[model samples]
Target: MPVRGGDLHVGVWEPEGGGPAPPTVLAVHGITASHVGWAELARQLPGVRIVAPDLRGRGRSRDLPAPYGMPTHADDVAAVLDHLGAGPVVVVGHSMGGFVSLVLADRHPDTVSSLVLVDGGMPLLPPPGVAPDEMAGLVLGPAAERLQMTFPSRAAYRDFWREHPALGPGWTDLTTAYVDYDLVGAEPELRPATRVAALGEDIRELVDGDSVQHALDHLRRPATWLVAPRGLMDEVPPLYPDAARDLWTVRYPAVRMVPVEDVNHYTVIMLAEGAAQVRPHVVEALGEAR
Candidate 1:
């Protein structure tokens, strides 16, 4: 789809059987992920059209230049909706994509009828004075480090993820396809498609910028935040820890937070178990929109 900077590659999944147009849902991927991240969830919702874009610096859009941040991503999403004539659709975002969803709702409210934030969009403050690069390192950990390394083969890349603490146990065909789509080059020179510079800027904005805060402050639409029990590393205490979750609840009482058990940040929308929990919420949101 043609957006402001360039043509963004989008993955569109329509209902299996040909029928009257079903309700639309604009699904957004995480910081380092692409549209393929939504494949598992899309398979479960046969009654909806799921449109996901490989955000400007990830997947097929890796060649897109700099100036990446939440606001720019929001504009791109709105452009996608306009191009597809799918406005007022339910917007579902996972991880950093959740932050993008909130900004989209704030900047282009008419394009979004409701929001489902899957383990993101809420505030996450880094320790005071952490540099942007350092913050990226802290937040993304191995996910960031992998971008700097080159893999000898696609199998090697798969092996790398197979050992990932969060993703390893939940690996499936959908997850494999998602990971395979992230690789850009050929043997011995293969690297993840996510642009490091764009990722750094996005991470900085996620922690330091006031865009998310402002979006949360002025939210007038129905929004639900689903939190996983673990972090990206599959460690105890999720990204939205108790203290953080409590503060968010007090601050944004209107945004409901639901705890999803037995899943980490990655599996929240990347695997079948997690998608099952998320599907009903998405369905309810879509039904309510009518």
Candidate 2:
């Protein structure tokens, strides 16, 4: 789809039996992830249309120029909805996409009817003693580190993720397709498509910038936050810790909190079990949207 800078790559999945206009879900992926990450969610909601986009600096849209931040990403998403003539659709965002979704609804209210925030969309203060600039690296860790590494082959990249503590154990064909789609360039020099600069900008915004905070304060749409108990590496203290989750609950009681047990940050969307947990929320949000 044509946006401000260039063409944005959007992956659209129609339900099994086509209808004139299926209920639509706009899925936004994580910081270093592509639209393909939503494969399981798309499959689970076979009756609804899934329209997912590779945000400007990741996936097939990697070359879309920077100025990368949640607001910019929000506008790009708004442009996508405008191009498709799709609006007031259910928006499901995972990780950084959740931040983007917040700003999208805040800035382009007409385009988003409701939100399904999978392990994201809330404010994350920098851990004590960690500088704002260092928070992304410390939190994102391996997911951000791989962008600087090069792989000899697609298989090599798959091997890298296969050994990942969180993603590896729950690996599936759906996850494999997502991993493959993130690779760009020729053999021996192939690298992840996410731009390091874009990652930095987005992380700063989500963790420190005021846009997300403002969005959270002004959020008017019905939203649901699906919490993952484990962190990015399948460790304790997930991204939205219980204390923070509690704080936000008090602030925005309108946004329902749904706990998804036994899944890490990655599995919440990549694996079947996780998608099963998320499917109902998407359906419910769509119902609310209508």
Q: Kindly list the per-residue Cα lDDT of model 2 for residues 256-285, writing each as its tens digit.
A: 998998999999999999999999888888
TM for candidate 2 is 0.97
lDDT of 1 by residue, 41-100 (tens): 999998789999999999998887779999999998899999998889999999999999
Off by over 4 Å in 2: none
Backbone clashes in model 2, listed as residue pairs: none
lDDT at 113, model 2: 90
Worst 10 residues of 1 by lDDT: 125-134
TM per candidate comes to 0.96, 0.97
